[model samples]
Target: MKSLTLDQLKALAQQTSSPSISIFLPTHRAGQDTQQDPIRFKNLLRDAEKQLLGSGMGPREASTLLQPAQALLDDPGFWNHQQDGLAVFMAVDDFHYHQLPFSVEELLIISQAYYVKPVLPLFTNNGHYYILALSQDEVRLFEGTRYAVGQIDLPEKTPVSMEAALRLDDKQKQLQVHTGTSQSGAGHGMFHGQGPGEEENKVLIEQYLNLVDTGLKEIFREQQAPLVLAGVDYLLPIYHKVSEYANIMKEGITGSPEHLRPEELQEQAWPIVESYFQQETKNAVEQYQQFVSTEQATDKVGKIVAAAFNGRVDKLLLSVDAQVWGNFNPETEKVTQNADRQSKQSNLALLDFAAMKTLQNGGAVYTLPQDEMPTDSPVAAVFRY
Candidate 1:
């Protein structure tokens, strides 16, 4: 399964020649409700078909537009394993489906552009994290959100197996094992000594971990996200001692991850990451409040939309329960908004627009419940200018 990424989101955010259909629904991982997942998807498609026809599209054309999503109903395999929610976006030439980690309210938006606010939670600062699974034979890296985890392709130079790495020429030393440095995968006991010199086993395992950490140096350089390791208990501490990665989590998934699947790794990883995200959010809110009476921060939607587009927003907070229907003229930096949703699909969700702009300009975007917003406004920003 592919994780929902920033690039993919930007692609979906682009304007298309045809109307875009965005649909979201809660899903069940198991039980009888798994059967109901597709049924609900089918219902959403049906609603879309009606809306498409009502928009002056012919029946045949409408069917063709929805064919890709409709095909999912019969794929029992597709529905069998799902996360907390599902988000689908379909246009005349594009179709994408993401398995979400958190529940979403059932929603259908037939708009000129894709409705993306429903999925913004997954893209917030500290929202995307990584899981590095280590075992004696292989190293697996997964990109995950709050509830979903998907394995990512490791860089070629990275070691896939500890045994394979150790197999390199015995005469020529593999790597200088470092000691006393602190850091933090599937932990199998190939090195755990039950029958031999325990001291020798520790040295070999540390050497393997040193090589593994060196191999991952490139991956760690590009990321500031938290990393969770899954492996045996003893190996866990050894990894911590050799890792150079900045944000390795103190808690780890114990037991060999050799046979465990990505979802299983995610199940054990979320509780550990949840506290980190929550505290980060709490700190962000506190920062926003500190600047609320200053010129650096404001809840004014008009100023936010403009600042976001001009690369001035450093952090954006949007109300998950609200949308300000409007149009923003970027050239003039003017905002025109409606109090409620408008009938025309061309009307923009200004909050969504603001959030996207913030992300595009290398700023962070977070969704907060309406009651948690610093001011009573639906949108707020801490600006660079």
Candidate 2:
């Protein structure tokens, strides 16, 4: 099933007067042992509704009325629900007030499930802190001990007193850097006229560049995965310098690293990386559309019909709101709105005609909503030479 987006959920909530409900059932045998049958489940829900009505409550309050039923199922003393693996029921009133069941384990599973999918977060820093090893959809973090499996140890370089290291694991398809700064020796050197003068600044910059180069080379040598540069703005220039020497396909640096903790950073970065991948996919789709537009026989629909009649259309594009009805003769290049039995009777609807012509001639058809359609023209087709 396709994943739901925030926009889609908002639209759905607006359409339905009542909230959406989600139910989770454990597939493991322990939970299944006490699982209610489908028939019993329906009957219980019906009874709960009847009880609500008996108490002079409206149908809208049925869920509140059914709390007792849910409690009974979740009761630890009675059912040991948590130990046996629990189920979850959620009703989303709005985007913000989506309520989940009380089980921590269940909530964890739901959170992880959502995180496991590709997400696009607008203000993320980089993919390195976000993406997990091996899995395209998992996030890695330090607090949870979710470190990349083969993380390399980067000892602190003395001149700069910064710990910098690269981790590369090809089998996991992950590359990352662990970086931290130590107290500068010149913090109080100004009193003794030993402060980090211009020379010291140069030394620091050089050390930073060296660390970045080492990290970038390790990533390129191992996986050739896309580069994700994160951390403070001050550190971003170092990544830019490294990019000059590396074959980085894409890169981004975010403004804030919300969670000072490593684990939190990982979670925050996942969506940003996912968004980058989504944008790339959308670009590919647009390119294919441009290719079709370029190969079109003529700018007019009439010419497109002629090409279709000769089974020459390679692809077709049409407005979702378009209305067309016609039959065409391949040999004569003539189109008839209404054909009799004497003329070869064609049952192709306008939309179907365009699609069939394109497919039969080794092409594809795309339909877009009226608002989304690239052109106001009724129909367009690409033709083979």
Candidate 3:
């Protein structure tokens, strides 16, 4: 899982919508008794009520929030139905701000559960040039209609001389190159000014361009990949002029020669790719937010989870650093925390739950690193109805 930067999170936050309900469940322990003690159950409920009230919920709202447990409370058969359980539920917007129930622990858990993941970027071999892809999370070496083939390195740091040339294949794909020679002025003017300098320079450039054209023709016989001119900035224009006569795509040429090794260039190009994808991702998120905010999209975690259980989820979003520690029944697609245990696994991390639920429903899960999560609403999600 790739970690996301803070900038990514801010972008995502601008797109997330608030959920309808947020439930917080504490851990519980099942005793060895076959029968649940009535007194003990009542006391547990009372304790839960006190905690909810302290969080600002009125008695009525808190009671209504916990109404789901009423079935178990009234029916002795339901009391001991599960091994042992202790949890709390909260409905967002149902209670006023002053009547809301929230704890520092809950806040911390939620924060950790909502981190996002970052995407890798693509770059060119030449340090001077780069391209960005459309996929926000995925990056390719080519951008627009241009694609990269392979790069080469010269034995010497500087070429004795530089030249340009062009070539055309049967398929009409144009190829060009700016070649360098070890001999100074061998093709043009030099100290000697005697050798077939101009002719030799012309030949070298023509041969290089021919070789490039042949390779491209064989690789993409029926189709044409855009041409790229890379070497020295001075030679690019020369190559362009030579290839101008061919049916070459004007957009294929790189503006300048690369100054760094392939590896270094790739590193530098990543930022450009990221920027491109960021814009696209932002646009999609904005659209999603608008739809969700209008109530056309269901944004609640619980509802999403329930929908996922029914195998209706399309996409799942979560933070990579998010940890879920809890007891989950895969068969029922239900989740509950192990509040009674101190171990991390029993704690039921919210992000983990979202991932698990998403997977169970055959939905794709995307976990973003903390920095990559949305700034406004970092909560993980299952996108469906």
Candidate 4:
């Protein structure tokens, strides 16, 4: 599966194809459960074929459209290395799949466009977060969303290991190892006193962290995503001191990350980002409520959908349990809300469309339960103007 990226999302959003197929399935990274992944995929394909046939497509045409995805059932290599979920998109002229870091609800949609709402987290503040795992031996970097984490490679010459990044003399190299839990188990950034002692080891460790921060900044320069650090209890503060990245989270995972797999580290990292994401959405909701008396925000789906198409939406909060099925004509600024979703072939998930346009036009989108919204509406927005 191809790595998910913004370019792919944009391409999917800009697609003007009919009878598009989008499929999602929860997947296992490894273990005995891996065997079930292909089986699940096979079932989803069968379901997609049934949907296509029901949509009035000839049987051969439907089979041909699904052929690419059907080919994956026999590929064991693909099944063994999945992330937390999988996404597949197919159209007459397009076919691609993304191995996602977070689990997606099992779904399949055949519509005029791809069903993209579930994957929005990967593109917005809700899903775009970073992880910096530091240890004496190696420093690892990962980009994560709400539920999944993927390791990102540091640039060439970036200091990944204490040995590689440090200029320690032969004596220091051998002694440069160690960490210890506080006797009380109640401290952070706590260095293990091993070879020379805590004071001397801290000096070297600080230098190592500085190098990491500098290298990371090259990639984080234009990014607004919050970053979480993972390491021994004491090292977090040292890295924080040397890092100028504005979004380093105040909280972090306290442990050695050197040997932890990316998914293993994700188990520790998601809560930090999820809390951050929730607070971000909360703040946006408050802004919407505060500006409700003015024109800067609104909960009306009609106004919000139009604004999203014109790039006026600064942030959007869509409800996962809601759908306003309809059709929108962006060129004429025309839209219709359908009480019956299946009454017309052109009806769209209007809420999903707004979320897609918001992302496409460089705005943030959050999917929250309806009760948590700024108003009782299924959709809410803070405008750019």
The C-alpha TM-scores of every prediction are: 0.77, 0.28, 0.31, 0.79
**135-163: candidate 2 lDDT, tens digit per residue:** 11111112111221112222223112232
Count of clashes, each model: 10, 2, 23, 8
TM-score of 2: 0.28
- Give the higher-TM-score candidate: 1 or 2: 1
Ranking by lDDT, best first? 4, 1, 2, 3
Write the number of the candidate with greater lDDT, choosing between 1 and 3: 1
Ranked by TM-score from best down, the candidates are 4, 1, 3, 2
Give lDDT tens digits, candidate 1, residues 223-286.
4578899887777889999988878999998877778888888888989898998887787788
- Point out where model 4 deviates above 4 Å: 1-3, 30-32, 53-61, 123-128, 141-223, 233-238, 241-245, 259-275, 339-343
Instruction: Provide the lowest-lDDT 10-residue window in model 4.
Output: 185-194
TM-score for candidate 4: 0.79
Candidate 1 C-alpha error for residue 246, in Å: 4.9
Give candidate 3 regions above 4 Å deviation: 1-263, 293-299, 305-317, 337-378, 382-385
Candidate 1: stretches off by over 4 Å: 126-128, 138-160, 163-224, 232-246, 250-271
The candidate 1 region of ten consecutive residues with least summed lDDT is: 173-182
Local error of candidate 4 at 154, Å? 6.9
Off by over 4 Å in 2: 1-199, 221-226, 245-263, 292-385
Question: In candidate 2, which residue pairs get closer than 3 Å at backbone N, Cα or C atoms, i.e. clash?
Answer: 121-271, 134-172
